[model samples]
Target: MTQFDAGTEFDRQVRTLIEKGFGELAGLSADAYADLLAPLRATVTDRAAGMEAPTEGRVPFVLVITRELAPIERAVPLLTLGGRKRKPGIIDRHYAEGDLVRFVPAKEVELPDARAYVLFDVDRGEEFCGAIPNDAMATIAGRGRTPLTMEEGIALVTQYPAALAKNKCFSLGGSRCGDRRVPAIWISENAPKLGWCWAGNPHTWLGMASAADRAGSLG
Candidate 1:
């Protein structure tokens, strides 16, 4: 994987999002979307100074737009893997639009109300691969960490597609539909896909993704 300076990575994220038509999805012009995120550039630079790149894990931080601004259904389609053509990410047919809305962040995960924020120390928890989603959530909480929500999981992949490696995919255990369904991102036909798995069932290839914490605003 290639590493970039904090400023460069931040710039790349903005450029990538705009190129993917995130602004249009959010009903804003490309220029407006870039301008809206201007305030976050300084925050990324400052926070990045004190943080060291993890030897293993996703990335130091990821820039994320909330579901309110970029709906998961729309945002997932923007993702591509292995440099292939962008494929639309899909929610399981079992879940209607209403079911998607019910899958909020777990109580242990506190998110800010701001439309955009930074998620730090993101990790596609490979160590937990094969563990039940419910058990993984408990372990993550015991370590004082929070599991990644569906939107947050998508945001990580949006910034770093390489994170969704084959045989090493991850689950968004932080978002629960008040039932057994846990959202996950994995490779499907060499493209990134958004789908779900049973919370109580263990999959050898799927780990629960998590983060150390999140910041809603730089201010």
Candidate 2:
């Protein structure tokens, strides 16, 4: 029932990840360590707090996945409607392996092949890779104008049952926003309690602990 600051939660997660994964700096002076950590924290904190949704699909969420944990590549069951009969097809979407996935609005697509044809089947309500024989990029544009509210964000996470069922997301409770602690949750894949990571932010870099037990306490 209290307000909460997202940045604080983000800081704690970054610190924990560093400590657990990097261990104590054996040779560095205290000041040196402090110096080293300051920028790391600032860089990560700002990225999470200031993350913007993508501009293209305007997809309301971005799933930031850590590099250490590669996305689980499994085909999701997709029903494609055409030819007077619905056909079952499999589409590839990156699912988090074991780290919290940060959610941002869809701004652009980082396609594996820049020249590949993208397809959007309005009749089927599905988007997938296609052999359209054209270089035009297909996108699900014209959506996600309103900024997401806290409630709406939470709801967005619940929609991905596969991610949640795997315990890929977590919730944080009792963080001071302004004067009170509020309940907060991050439902992105492998999301830590704070829901952002340096591994996946800025650029996909390596060296971060996996999200196996990084759920953190409800506080």
Candidate 3:
């Protein structure tokens, strides 16, 4: 959790003085926090291996990032939870009771119960389509739930709407609707955890979390 003063360089790039929004974390001073974004970017070394960073300079990707209790991205949560059954257009997955799930920085926010979710799986399937669910709609308004690994969460989207069963053609590189690279709902909703500044793509009626915008609201 890094905090940059309003006129600092980081503030110009991020354009939000990140600390201004976090009034709840009064106990922690702004000087003590550091944004993990820079170091996380360094983690990717080989683009040929598919382990690469996004173009727009990691515009704050907030996905569910599910994984087993194991360390790093070794244990795909979905694979461990339910065999990686490659369906035609979706990738179904889950998060067990004690699965180890953590966002990038691991600072604030208590995390949801880590329910079974379904978002476009960027790996085996085509490019992720649809808008990812945002935090406002994804997370419960009041109490926070348990944490889930990224592996387990993607499964739900793979097997969504009972419509996937009808998807005859296998998506080689595009999402279900075709060409919608933006995920309709992303669990990878990265929260600033720097102190409660979470945002993302779209979301469902259940109000899921993501880096995308809001999908369908309860209203």
* Best candidate according to TM-score: 1
Write one digit per residue (lDDT tens) for candidate 2, span 158-200. Answer: 2222222122222221111232212223222223122322211
List per-prediction Cα lDDT, in the order shown.
Answer: 0.82, 0.24, 0.23
2 against 3, candidate with superior lDDT: 2
The model with the greater TM-score, 1 or 3, is 1
How much lDDT does candidate 1 score? 0.82
Q: Write the per-residue lDDT of candidate 1 for residues 1-219, one digit (tens) a residue.
A: 445478887898899888878889889998899988878888788877656654435688888888888988788888876466466665556677677778888766778655888788899999889999989988998999889998898888887877888778999988887778889988886678788899899999999998988876566
For all predicted structures, in order, the TM-scores are 0.91, 0.22, 0.22
Off by over 4 Å in 3: 1-69, 77-106, 109-132, 135-139, 143-198, 203-219
Give the worst 10-residue stretch by lDDT in candidate 1.
Answer: 49-58
Clashes in each model (backbone N, CA, C under 3 Å)? 0, 16, 66
Q: For candidate 1, report its TM-score.
A: 0.91
Looking at model 2, residue 90 earns an lDDT score of: 27
As a whole number from 0 to 100, the lDDT of residue 107 in candidate 2 is 34
In model 2, the number of clashes is 16
